[model samples]
Target: MAFQWQVDPEDLFVERYPQMVGTGLPAADVDEVRAAITDMWPDRSGGWVHEWSRLAGRYAAAGSPWRAALAYGWAKFPALADTPKRTALSRQVDQYLLAAPDFDVAFDRIIVDAPYGGGHVAVPVHVLTPPGWSAADPVLLASGGVDSWKMDLHGWFTELALRTGMRVLAFDIPGTGETSMPLSADRGFDVVRALIDHARTLGGGRVAHLGISMGGYFSARSGLAGEVDAAIVLGGPVERSFDPDRTWAYGMRGIVGNALGFDTEPTDTELAQRMSAFTLRQWLDQDRNAPMLVLNGADDVHIPQADTLVFKGRPETEVLLIPGTGHCAVSKFPEALRIMIDWLVASARW
Candidate 1:
């Protein structure tokens, strides 16, 4: 069966354009690529991947590796399902590495062993250390959603490092980006635990976690398990999103399926069955939890509001529902980032 998109691809392009620019893509380049995209799925000219790749090549030839990386990032934009998209992801990584040396903050890309399914998987992580950072400072493990992987979040990570004077560790969550493992609720936690363990080795061993979008699910799990010093869940689903009766909006179902490592789109029943294993309800009743901050836009179309509300009565947890915004409070991200950074600084002191 053919994959069906919940939202029209053309409309999605228009809706996501602002977010692309917000995340650091040049406006003029994005406009050119947007104008060239007549087919969203085809692999040839006028297709999403083709046009974006064309722009990426131009940027690369012009000695603008960062811009090339951003363009290639959009080429792989929602998922890495097809060959062209996967190729785009490869180029994205190459361009990002090429641009890394010029980053304002110093960083190191290291590989750590993450235990998974009776063995270990090599996980690539980017650790950025701010000026004057020392062993006495704290560390933060940060990650983005299924679609926006580690490289896509470089700006946010750098900003956090610079503003907080904390070492920022960024990695792709399981089943996304360069992670070798597929998404399985039980196994995914193992990957996160491994990251936490590695994080504890850096700085003062005071570690925090910041998860955005689907990445928030892992952060919530780490918090509930008391694995990190603090955890930030920004627009992540904790419970209701996995309910069989819950519905997805704006093509989230298919997008999630692709991130879940599905070769083809799964039926609603199959999706629900798989997703149910991801809910954190069983852990909610537990007494132990890290200091947690749960945040999301009140009108998030992707995640149910109940997911953020679920933390209301939990001890040592702060929940914020930004009004008049959408998922992750993208429209008001600067405000949200300030709140998150302040919370992290305070959490570290404790």
Candidate 2:
């Protein structure tokens, strides 16, 4: 059984439209899509995938591969459970490749093996090196959450490389995007550690991590374990989010369940048990961590403000709660990005 969304499709589309536009989709194109999508599921004629893919086809025909990629990206939005969504993901990757050659920075897509389940899982990574970057320069590992994958982050990655002068390596975290492994709380950090190690080899033995939303969990883990020189977590849940007593807000259960590798939605108890392994509370109690910056919107409803506040007293850690914005400070993203890049440069000495 596929996880069914509890929220209405139209409402979901309206809520996520701004984010799509923020990720580089032209506002007019997205609005056109909004007029076409009457259903959220792929099975319907005017469904989310169908309408978005239709728009993508137009962009591809017009030689606007980046726009086409963004359209296809929305076609597979939220999760990749059904066949149509999976196909959209494939098209999204193809269009992303088509646009890569025209990118401002040098880009390379590399496949590396990361240990998982006592074996190696092939992980696809997008590396962006700045114009003057060298092998001995600093490297930053960047990633997005379950819904927003690596290709969706190209704008941010390119900006980071250009503004900070650090080579940027972007990848989807486990169970999301192109990662071959399913989401396992116990084994997910293996992917992060592998990327950190690979980053070390690419630069002057100094590596940093910047993770958005759920990807921020990995950043916290890497920092807590002293794996990276610095780590930044933006709107990432750290603790209390996995508490069995707490309920998932904003119809997030279905989307998160899909990323957790669940074909059928689990009961609250079952989900809690699985999520228990993801908490970093134990490590937080310990006295060691890399230099870290933790941030989130003060009004973020998806993750409790306490998750960001928990890092306040920790050594070498800075916390910022952007006022009047929502998750990941999406509304004030440019400000957040500036703060993040500045902190990374000074903390990592890039």
Candidate 3:
């Protein structure tokens, strides 16, 4: 609960910085992080990594494991296949594990068979049993976005665990975090299906999927594939998500490009074709899907409102569009999370 690091409201990096600071750092330590990041503005290397790493060490030395973990994670944000990025990621996991005991959760790192390609991959799943949890209780497979890894969503997982007494399994989607799989346009839902299969073994063959941002795309797809009993897609893109004509910001484009394994940024046309592999509209068959809830911010820049609109009148689907909020309606995350959890509980009961 040390997420107090606040960035300036008017900061140019406001698009990504606020969530970065809000989710990962303590409020009291906000100034130091802000100052360091400011000094390293427009630079992802050199002093930037050093500043965050030093800050992380300071927090670790002070026994604030969560802050340390977040600092390390920030050090690797907008990940690149580099030594420093890899080191920061490893340290982030280490600090997160160091903080897990305090939260009363048993963290386990394991490997599961990827449903595609006949390959095995490592997935770090955080396991938390809420009070009154039973072996027959259902499980929630929680996931995060491109910039925010599974570690970033730990708080959300704990909230779901407490709210429903369901065992929560937090894992990275195929391309992010410690998931040992190559990133591809068609990689996510298969990985999630594999995870759902794994979740069933832990909880009486009952599991639900909830995902944020790009993970929401996978959650929606999982529901369409009947991979899970219930699914919630928060700020996920379905139709326009692949349209080259839909304007995307530099950072958003970077994330999509990077996730698809491009060594360099791809042309908009190439990016469109690459992303086309993920378009769900063409594959959707309403009769074969599970009940789903699609929610997003009316102002979400990365995901167009059209994405949410396309789900309208779809069988067993409900959509919530909040005005004046940004991507995934992250500004209303706590409220949205409550709604998501309640729906999951109700969906499971049905």
Q: Return the TM-score for each candidate structure.
A: 0.95, 0.96, 0.89
Give the per-residue lDDT of model 1 (tens digit) for 93-200.
Answer: 999999989998897999989889999999999999999999988899999988888898788889999998999999988888888577778798898898889898
Q: Give every collision pair in model 3.
A: 4-25, 4-26, 4-27, 5-26
Q: Rank the candidates by TM-score, best first.
A: 2, 1, 3
* Model 3 TM-score, all chains together: 0.89
Tell me how far the alpha carbon of residue 172 in candidate 3 is from the true structure, in angstroms, after superposition: 0.9
- Mark the 10 consecutive residues where model 2 has the least summed lDDT: 1-10
At residue 310, what lDDT does model 1 achieve?
Answer: 88
After superposition, the stretches of candidate 1 with alpha carbons farther than 4 Å from their true spots are 1-7, 347-349
Q: Model 2 over residues 112-207: C-alpha lDDT tens digits?
A: 788998888999999998899988778999999978888987888789899989999999989888884677776989878998999899889899
User: Model 1: what TM-score?
Assistant: 0.95
Clashing pairs in 1: none
In candidate 2, which residue ranges exceed 4 Å CA deviation?
A: 347-350
Q: Which is better, 1 or 2, measured by TM-score?
A: 2
Q: Count clashing pairs, candidate 3.
A: 4
Candidate 3, residues 73-164, lDDT tens digits: the string is 87766554456666888898889888977875555656666665665565667777777788887888888877677887777778788887
Instruction: Give the Cα error of residue 254 in candidate 2, in Å.
Output: 0.9
